[model samples]
Target chain A: MTALLVSVIAAATPLLLAALGALLVEKVAVLNLGVEGMMLMGAIAGFAVAHSTGNLPLALLAAIAAGMALALLFAVLTLTLQANQTASGLALTIFGRGFSALVGAGYVGIAAPTLPRIAIPGLSDLPFVGPVLFGHDPLVYFALALVGAVAWFLYRTHAGLILRAIGDQHDAAHVLGYKVVRIRYAVVLFGGAMAGLAGAYMSLSYTPLWTQDMIAGRGWVALALVTFAAWRPFWVMIGAWLFGGIMYLALYMQALGVPVPTALLSALPYLGTIFVLVLISRDARRIRLHRPAMLGRPFSAGG
Target chain B: MLSLSPRGTASEFWRYAAPLLALALTALITGAIFAFMGRPPLLTVTTFLVTPLLAPGGWEALLVKAAPLVLMAVGLSIAYRANVWNIGAEGQYTLGALAAGGLALALPDAPGWAIYPALMLAGLLGGVAYASLVAWLRTSFNANEILTSLMLAYVAQYLLVYLVTGPWRDPDGFGFPQTALFSDAASGPRLVEGSNLHLGLIIAPLIALAAWLVLNRSVLGFQFRVFGQAPRAARFAGFNENRLIWLAMAISGGLAGLAGMFEVTGTQGQLTINLGPGYGFTAIIVGFLGRLNPLGVVPAGLLLALTYLGGDAAQMNLGLSSAITGIFQGILLFCLLGSDVLITHRLRWRVRA
Candidate 1:
């Protein structure tokens, strides 16, 4: 039971982080669909750094930087060039996958030092919660803290209000002199950083090795998690954990020798995402209420 | 400093020149990438992009690769025109191939004329059925086709995997996860004496031309343009958005399926485990680079096909990674998007006075 819980948390951490990044970007009315690519870049860079230097913090920072670089590219295109967000995001993903695969070609089939686990001395001695919650790595805790942090930042703070307002009506925010473009750049970068961190969590802590396209569809799942949560940070946590459980459920079924095709089982997460999307998207009015009005629309001041 | 100002009207010159400019910029930047990787920049770039065409049998391979690409891009370009995003062409292609291959496997001894057309029809229907799922969900549930279609792609891949590895595995093939080779009747006849070139080479371009005519001259094409350019206007004009979505999906999916069928009928006469190369995703680039014009897709398809060939060559000769192909493709797209802005706006040199 404890092992199952631990494994589920490991799976959920990456999705949670990536979804949080996407959530922030969505909140600002900028749909940067390159989360998959940014995650891959983060995975490769993090693995490369950790393998060479054996410095986990430095490795994490490297991952974050890799993600931010790609985000910067997206920003330049969609914000400056005013390219279509959907196409630009696809370009970013394709580039990220290619660039990471090129860089990680040598890193494949290699193991890297993982993030060190830190167990709280007093809290770890508690009853049933002790083993599952306390003795995980720093990222597991950092991801949980980020949920609260994102919620607080988005709801209680003046900046968060401006971010929401920008997503809802960028022209209005621009007239009020909130620096819509600059703030978007900041959120987009932050989203990239979190995606990178999520990717590193996979390479550094979860798997401890590098592989091409290792993140698989988890990045896409993270994107779906944003919709599943209706862009709410707290619900994103729940959705991430839920998806994590569903994804692992497939493996468990396989291990238990269930009378089902393994390939079909492998496809469960994607199918589940589609099912969940259908459920949520059925209510068009509900989506309209929470969805950023200016999402994926190019914003120009005084156009 | 440079600034961009609206031209108030689209520039006809840039409309023609944007793709060319993007191509030139891609070559320049790609050369720099080779240099950064510590290779002779010019030679590496030439070897990667140009040398493949000069190599023996290279043109034949390019034609073979371009066949499927042009077909898929034709479908996608039309759909993109109607503002329908069906990015799951890969999945549609896989199902098409599977359906056709299954038919071929079932009736391997059937006459070529009879079996081949049946196979093609199966491929077309298979694609249409799969794509309809996306259309139905989007029109009914307001679900995003981008995600749903992409998700369905994963499912299609797994379905293919299950069939090939389990039920369809060749008994005499020594533990390989593949089906037996199709009979000669099922493989279809080749066009040339000594090349992979087949009837698909002719069919792909012909289909593109047909699509070009329909898109440019047909009333349905007018509806597509109206719907994409102004959805509100299209609605007011009494155009059915749902039917358009269905039509677009069916067209793209069917073309993708046909391409997959061509692959099977050509060199890949058997279902195999390693059937993926992301032709669907790359075709999206082809659709865009071609300016979403069917006639333009022919050249666009060939250029991108060169990337696949060059990527293999670079991997073998320069020991460059295969991912370089994807990087270059992505760079080409970014260049296209950047240069495309010039079609609507011009860069002006502003001197502060």
Candidate 2:
């Protein structure tokens, strides 16, 4: 039970980080749908940096930088060029995947140095809950801590209020002298950094290897989690944990020889997302209250 | 400082010229990437863009590859025109192949002509049914079709995996994750003696022509245009949004399914997980590249199909990774999207205040 719990946390950490970042972008009212692509770039960049430098921190920084670079490209197109957000975002994903694959070709078959587990001095030795709660890699703790920080930042801080205000009514925000595009640029880049961190977690800590298309659909899953959480930070964390548990449960069930179709089990997260989306969207009031008001709309000061 | 100023009306000259500009930009960017990779840019470009058509068997292979792309893109263009984003055509394609392949397996002894049309129909229905699920969710629950359709595509892929590795695994084949070879009677009719070109080449253009007629000459097509251009006006005009969504999904899904069936019976000659390298996703580019016109998709499909052949040639001759094709495709899409700015605005210089 403890082992399973630990595994679930390890699996969920990347999602939590990615979802939190996506949540931030949502708060700013700009939808960056290239999380998956950004994540892939992060994974390969992280792996390449870690493999060559053998420094986890440096590898993570590289991953974050890579993700931010991609986000910047998206920002330029959508913000400056006034292109369609959906199309530009899709292009980012496609380009990210292709670029990562091209770069990762040389890094295939190499094992990344595993991140060390940090067991709390005294609490980690406690019975039952010790390993589950106190023993984990640093990234897992950071992801959980980030949820709390994001919730506080979004709910308590003035900057957070401004961000949400922009999401709710961009024209109004623009009227009030908020630098809508500049703030959005910063927020989008932050989301990219967080997504990159999540990708780094996948290659450096979770799986500890570089493979083409690593990070798989985790980025998409993270994007879905934002909507599933109704764009709330606390709920995003809970949703991440739930998905992580389901992901590990699939493996655990197969290990016990439970006769479930392997493919069906593998598909549970995606199917679950659609099911959850239907359930959530049915509550029109809740969606109206939580969904970013101008989620995919482009804003230009001159216009 | 530079700014983009909207013209009273977009320049007609640039409307036709932007795509050409985008293509040129894509070539330059891709050539730069090749140069960075230590490959001769000119040689690599020739190999990837020009050499394939000159090589033996190139035109036939290009036609074979292009058949499915054109079919899928034709359907996609209609859906896009209706402002119904059906990204799950890939999933629909997979399901169509499954349904058609299942029928072929069921009637292994049937005559070629008899089973072929039946398979195509089955494939079309399979795609329609799969896509209807998205339409149903979008209409009934207001679920976002973009995410739902994409999610379904992943599920469909896994379903294909399950079938190929489990129930459909060939008995005579030594544990290989594939079905038995489809009988010759179930295959697509060839266009030439001992060539890969099949009936898909003929069907693609016919469908494109039919689609063009429907989009340009029919009341329903006008409704699609209105819905895409102005949703409020469409609603005011008493067009049912939900019905339009369903119609769009049905048509696109059905065509995608037919493409899948053609690929299985006509090209691969059997069903496998490797039946596509994302013809459905690539078709999205074709639809956009063709400016969402069915007639335009023919050349768009052929252009994309060229990349595939070129990519393979580059992989074999220039020692480039197959991913070069994906990179090139990505660049093309970005260029296209960026160039669309010229459709409504133009670059200008203004004096500082």
Leading candidate by DockQ: 1
In the range B61-119, model 1's lDDT, one tens digit per residue, is: 99988888999999999999999989899999888899999999999799999988888
Evaluate residue A136 in candidate 2 and report its C-alpha lDDT on the 0 to 100 scale. 88
Per residue, candidate 2 scores C-alpha lDDT tens digits across B1-353 of: 78788878978777667778988999999989889988889899889999999999999888888888899999989998888989889999999999999999889999988988899899999999999999999999988888898899989999998998889988887988789988888885788967777787999999999999999899999999999889999999999999999999999999999999889988887777687888888898888888889998999899999999988999999888888877888889889888888888888888889
CAPRI accuracy category, model 1: high
Q: Indicate which candidate wins on lDDT.
A: 1
lDDT of 1 by residue, A137-253 (tens): 999999999999999999999999999999999999999999998999999999999999999999999887889888887888898889889999999999988888888899899
What C-alpha lDDT values do all the predictions have? 0.91, 0.89
Residue A190 miss distance in model 1 (angstroms): 1.1
